[model samples]
Target: MSIIKKLASQTAIYGLSSIFGRFLNYLLVPLYTYHFSAAEYGVVSEFYAYAGFFAVLLVFGFETGYFRFRDKNDPQRDSAYSTALWFVLGANLVFLLLIRLVRTPLSEALHYAHHPEYVEWFAIILGLDAIASIPFARLRAENKAFRFAGIKILEILVTVGLSLFFIAYCPPLYAKNEQVWFAPIYDPGIGLGYVFIANLAASGVKFVLLTPQLKGLIWGFDRVLFRKMVGYSLPMVVIGFAGIVNEMLDRALLKYLLPHDPLMNMRMLGIYSACYKLSILMSLFIQAFRYAAEPFFFAYADKSDARRVYADVMKYFVIFCMAIFLLVTLYIDFFQYFIGREFRAGLGVTPILLLANLFLGIYVNLSIWYKLTDRTLMGAFVSLGGALITIGLNLWWIPHYGYVGSAWATLACYAAMAVVSYLLGRRYYPVAYDLKRIAFYIAFGLGLYFAREPLLTYGYRSWQAGTLLMGSYLLSAALFEFRGLFHFRKKLPAGDSGKSLGPGRK
Candidate 1:
């Protein structure tokens, strides 16, 4: 219970950036959906999807490798940080140069020869972000959560400010009076491209914000350590690539797999992506928790009671995810308004995707077994299996059901991976998780969600039903974990043994 409190505290600090900062970023979704056509927004979503894959390639998993080797294996290690930083820096440099050469050909292949600037801009943005990865990871490694949250918030502000300048403020001013003071930054022809440009500008600012990380740091590269670290972390790249497949492949694949024309296909993709953002609350929590949990888990791995702590964390994680699932799905009528009217038709996929993200978070937590045991290749295999499921299902289903099929495919992939990871993890490194209780929590929350629509017309209101469902569920959880929640201790008679019984696990 104490350790869980610590984890929750850290997650809250990290959430300032992940949830709050991204909430500010989420404002852009409505802005984009309202201003640009669905086809235009889809292009932005598709390019960012490709960026997700490239970002993984750029890091090659050195961030986790740094955490494992420097912090856990050899706490006194001095050069691991510099070694990882320089290696990724050089890799990103090479990537930037390579992209410069193929930018034209790549643009033409993507039917964007006329706007190769998009490809050129994103390559630089991705490369710069890749180089910044280690500095950012260093903050996490050192438990510098506030610094991290601050820099991330600043980055989001840059993005939002630039986007508004170009998309909202500058356009009308430029049209009515081209000589206005801020008119030069606006270009109506750019359309959805401002979104990418805003991203590029903000990414550049992230480097500047993190410049202080370079001080008091060793830049000297250790060839031997670099080689060893890469050897260990290389398999993580596969895991990361597969993870991206589960996340972004549907958007990329929908273009060619669907029978519709390119424009119409993009429009449908845009609709799905917009609605997908509506389900991001669960993912937001997972991201925040991951940032805090990964370092905490690794740092505490050597403790004798670490497995018990991990088990408790898992139970609490599922409980919170289920709560979030109900929170969003129960009030989805309002969330769908975050997207344009055309996009709201796909709101049915939100709950499916939300559950999928919950499973993904579980898989992430389970992945620590492989990370701790250094059996990272097993993690790679699990992710690869999930990737295959993602690819096969998206290919077969997209033609028939479009993006809705993709949503269900994501849920299936994550759920399968979670089960496989748990089974394999227990075989190799058993943790006595209270699976029955956790399963009941998930099932109960889902039952409440499913019961919402049916009761809507039977004199039940959403808020009223939501309050009843969530309130009762919380009370049930409190009673189930009363020992921890209430911290009850037995009363002893005066002068009697002077010892009191503490709370017991139910």
Candidate 2:
């Protein structure tokens, strides 16, 4: 099969889990938004932002290391795996111990000293998830895409099911029969804490399900292999850390930089976070694309025409992402219903964030230049630059503008990285990406978007207005650039006909 076809198949399978899993989890947005106040949901948002940061640390770039080294034609693949496993295991153990030892200080730092249990539980959860990551990467490398997708879907289903039962169903049952099983442990006042417990339970179940992958693996540690993998993966650690900080630093900083009330600040964050989830469709596509593209890129890196293929891939990637952005923004009046009424106030940021995510996806496509060339340190530098820009913008803007500042900070950070990478990649590796044509498409889409508001003032229904705008954009592409829309394959003439047409094959 062609590489593109193979990638599409794998992406479909992986996206099944991601799309459906996200949709299922998406249900929780309404549940949480309805049940908890914006402030309460903000706690959930803030904590998970920390989770994203800590997760990058716990995995320590071993996932990328596994991918980089697993293809080596050596007998030490198992040794590499074991070495990475042991390194994370040791680090996680030490991390957990340290957190436990300083639980008081940690709790105080988070201003949740009364809830040190939250810290303790979160620490254990992070540790388990970190250790599980290497094996997960192994699954991806081994092309066990089906198993990987299934486990992921199963985990999401279990988590969603438990959360619904606890938050939506359990309260009513307990209210009617106070003497029912485990009544003492159930507290409706705990609010967002139930979300955490459900996550812990689901994560534990995934660890159990992944035991088959763990079984029968040799467990011997190799110091030499460990050193090599660390050397290779350390740059990726910096890259991952900086990349996540660029994405999440605003959320972490907003609590302190914004106004005084913890509850109000959290509420604003929650509103922003919920509205941000609307962009998950684009994020999900990029994620599935990356999962397929990474290994495919490495495998094809030595091919003579690889640069052309990369250029084609980027063109299509930008096309599809822009298409998604248009769809979301054009129909946002309807999409706003995904969150509760309180969150609708933050809907203004959704379009801005969606565009930022599109830029981020483009940046990921451009990043292949560095990865395939073994100039991975370039990625670290690019991400660090973006992170620094994000921090600076948030600090400068958040005090004055609050959540709007965070939104602009995110947009600026991603736009900077995408443009910077494209310029640098052209100098270093030089893929002839259709930048002029892509920019035209973006400009046309934006024009269509801005024009829609004025057109809607003429008494069109919301859907009618969106449909008109989307159709206009499509029609514009078809008319002005229809040749680019067509896919043609050249064919050879039949035996005798080939001879007749040999000199002038048209």
TM-score of each: 0.94, 0.92
List candidate 2 segments past 4 Å from native. Answer: 72-77, 181-185, 216-219, 474-482, 485-506
Local distance difference test, per candidate?
0.86, 0.80
- Candidate 1 residues lying further than 4 Å off, grouped into runs, are 71-77, 216-219, 483-506
lDDT of 1 by residue, 177-252 (tens): 8788865666678866788899899999999988887652565788898888988899999999999999999999
Residue pairs clashing in model 2 are none
| Candidate 2 Cα RMSD after full superposition onto the native fold (Å) | 5.3
| TM-score between candidate 1 and the true structure | 0.94
lDDT of 2 by residue, 244-266 (tens): 88778888888888875877888
Best by TM-score: 1
